[model samples]
Target chain A: MFEHFPQRVLVNEVVTRDGFQSEAEFVPTATKIELINALSTQGLNKIEVTSFVSPRAVPNLRDAEEVVTALNRNTDTTYVALVPNERGCGRALALDLDEINLVMSVSETHNLANMRMTCAQSLDQFARISAMTAGSAMRLNGSLATAFGCPFEGLQTEDTVLHYIEAYLEQGLHSITLADTTGMAVPNQVYSLCRAVRARWPDLEVTLHFHNTRGLGLSNVLAALAAGMNQFDASLGGLGGCPFAPGATGNICTEDLVHMLAEMQLDCGVDLAGLLTQSRQLEAIVGHPLPGQINKAGLRTDTRPVPESVTQLRQSLEA
Target chain B: MFEHFPQRVLVNEVVTRDGFQSEAEFVPTATKIELINALSTQGLNKIEVTSFVSPRAVPNLRDAEEVVTALNRNTDTTYVALVPNERGCGRALALDLDEINLVMSVSETHNLANMRMTCAQSLDQFARISAMTAGSAMRLNGSLATAFGCPFEGLQTEDTVLHYIEAYLEQGLHSITLADTTGMAVPNQVYSLCRAVRARWPDLEVTLHFHNTRGLGLSNVLAALAAGMNQFDASLGGLGGCPFAPGATGNICTEDLVHMLAEMQLDCGVDLAGLLTQSRQLEAIVGHPLPGQINKAGLRTDTRPVPESVTQLRQSLEA
Candidate 1:
């Protein structure tokens, strides 16, 4: 309804990759396949199926290859995977993924802390992967981790982020994601950054990935939307936390984000009710209460009857 | 740096009233007094200290009179109390309150449900309160609960809200709060309604009160701020919820709200670090963890050293 907010936005579900990665115990392959299949039909624009990292590093996603093999793929929804390095990208190349996402942190220390590589090494890896996937059917999307701020280094500069975006564009990556890995983003900062990025590259695809660690996730989303972002990465049931930041909420929730979009009367095509139902299933799968609010507080349409106390008070007042 | 947003915004803390009102156990009179006293010194522009409702109705706030009397009065802060009817207003008039807040719901059903009175009856109560406070120095603030939407009646129209606001103004209330009682507000709706309100009543002191139930709390605040609001009501540690909406989050957290405002570099005068410390005390008082995120994640300035794993990865790469 506002000036700059696009009528249509793309919701990219990152539950399986980001959400499940934080689980203390392994989620079975069959269960993962079932969830992804169920979500594929729910009108999500894309699903980050899994991350193609070493099993020893992230044992929770040890079945990434198998999960990719068995997806009940939907033509309407593109399937994607997070590929960490050239070796991971090589594995994704063999898969039936529509897109392979290459990620690096905008912060130097966070790149070392998260990917065990310097920002330079990660850029080199993205270049090598871009060349490797040159002839492949799969497309590449560069994800900048700690694009807003770094937990180890505090707030990163906008110039640092812009330099990395320039590097990603050089690699022929059409889509780029601004990842708030630690949820340190403020709305004004989000608006300023997104406006700059959109102004610089009008045709480039930009997706916003936010964490709810500090409860600014959805606010940051609103700011980005107003600043001309139309693609977002959200975790189903509000799952995922960085391994370094224990007990912190990870991503903007899929159901909550969709509910807000629908409430704003934006034509973000995802079924809120279906996502709410899936959030329950995810809670059972993860064996804990999710951080998502829509699942707990039903949609605005879910009207309630008058409480007995209110009724009793009304009767007393009349008397 | 953006247009329309004022350099200085007022923070109104509502923990002792809204936050403690939902507590299953009665907080001791001394503890409530202690909390209120501590918050007064934290540079908060205003604080909804307690409600003048009946002890029989809200047993948790049975010590409302005691809390009001015990506050270490701060000249820099305005102390407020929510009074439902003439009798409650009468009790507040006898106290040392800076402001007596009159509350009602814009939604008809919610008005009846929350106050055990119709909208007309609530208006009559506000008129009675205005007359009661005419000779006294106490200012009156009209709080329109469910101003955004009603739990029992779905989405409420802005016209419905403006109608009640007009009635509230007729009673001589220069200040009013638009309360999202159940967190049904979307950013666009907030922006639209707030813009209209500011345009019509340029001199009215408007405060935005939001719940984090649907995870749109902070987003709604940003929208209202952009729409020309300069004051807000937030609870400490995010402690408060509608009794009807079970398992729902209540108001936007004081700490998180201040944290975001500080991060935006806005000239909101509250000390964020002090609120963070108080949140820990609030947790201890409640005997459970509250929903606020900043308390757990720390501030963006809270930087960590490089993790051991990252150090090992660096050493291996060097070797």
Candidate 2:
């Protein structure tokens, strides 16, 4: 059934940044470093480490600089940081980050709500940031937040999203991430938008970041895959939600995603058992049960012990 | 994107049987009747009202007879009951049910664990029941439990499943349900099995019953849809779990499923808002939060009240 699918898909783990930023309690910088170092060993090619945002705006990630600076960077993994503006860009560049992920909302309302800037204003900032890194070795990836839907504006048109992509491309940022910020994307919408985006920019490295808020996260993954997307962003333990959107849930669980892909015989280089172990440590640090299903329910390959009743019944029948 | 898909899909609400049977608390027969009656008006074409099983095994559904007898059935809806054996068949036949749904496992270990009978013994029972109901006006639909994968047996081969299907066909049962009893099915498996089954039995009405145990429930639904299978079984608020399988979660949320189908412009003939309201009531009665995502996230059409920060940011930007 998946004979036509790519042999291997690229997965970028975004837990340290996306997952931790939404937490009510600050995850200690030491703990963040520990998690990132652990994730690096799990065969993940990319890990979003931290966000260089204002301390007051997101107190939970106030230790972003400390966490990034103290990380035991793995040579095989690219450690990226979320840089919302030129200020964030400067901070991340000073830290010698592998990649600076700049984000802007495709929806006008969401851009203002999230970054306190208009879409045009955010794009102008991104252009300035692009110019600043022109002669540098820094790689930039732009994320179009609410590319699928917005909490304030509801559904977004494909033209609206493509306009933002056009702006990002004009700024010389080739790698793009389409985010379903409000988790409102259905499979058809995912398929249609992804197909259109890939068609328009055939060379653009498209990555899908989906939220499981409406239980359509993995379904959207399948849709995006069918539409020819190869890169995806997922968080450990399904941690992370839109701080601006009330009741929005986390990104698709990284362990859960790997489990499904492995079950389908798709190559997702990460180790599922290792990710679950990390997820367990994360659950301990977070002091709660995670929203991830695979971590809670063992992998399909792990068999359950036969119940005593079944054993007794089998013996009785044999007798 | 859905140009090649069927215009409408059939959904059978299994809340009364699948959902209630898993609850620790015995919901009153009157309440069960009220819920079933409410479901009948929600544009659902089929509803599995109850399971006529040994009350000792599923004490929560002890009042199945009373609940089935008291329902206000809609003429457009088919009221079905789960009949595990000939005794349950007699009880369901006495009530003049629209459909008598017989279930058995495709995996040997799961059959022993769940039904305390061998695969052959279950088939023999089904054949006897089929013979008994031959001259009657009742319709029989067979459910191949763990058709996708078994918790005890891990995964069942397509040939193993097809062998069971042949037996059901030989017993004169036309309509069949392929149940993912332990939520172990992935999209590739669901797509391949469903397509193959439909190909072999062109006249058979195929229904897919999936669990959200590992969060692939709705994704499997999409895969089955692509494979030409239409009918699905979903529970309200995702309330249901296998009693034998530890850590197995509920069936795919009926409200969540409807919400996705409606958003995709697929015809399900179900009211999403009404189902959410009923789900809310079910949560209250169950005295706990349900496993559904849509009920908590609200519908995509719902406009969230602007966060104070967003409102203030907009005003400052305007200034």
The candidate maximizing DockQ is 1
- Candidate 1 global TM-score: 0.97
Instruction: Output the TM-score of candidate 2.
Output: 0.97
Q: Write the per-residue lDDT of candidate 2 for residues B49-118, one digit (tens) a residue.
A: 9999999998988998888888787999999999999999999888989999999999888889888899
Those runs of model 1 whose alpha carbons end farther than 4 Å from true positions after fitting are A307-319, B308-319
Global Cα lDDT for candidate 2 = 0.87
Give the true-structure RMSD of model 2: 1.6
Per residue, candidate 1 scores C-alpha lDDT tens digits across B176-202 of 999998888888899999989988989
Q: Write the per-residue lDDT of candidate 2 for residues A1-319, one digit (tens) a residue.
A: 2444667888999998899887888888888888899999998868999888999988988888888888888889988999988888899888888889999988887788778888889889989999988887888999999888888888899999898898898998858899988888899999889889988888888899999999999999999888878889999999987654455568999999999888988888998889999999999999977889988778877777778888888899999
Best by lDDT: 1
* Per-model DockQ against the true two-chain complex: 0.64, 0.63
Return the lDDT, model 2, position B223.
92
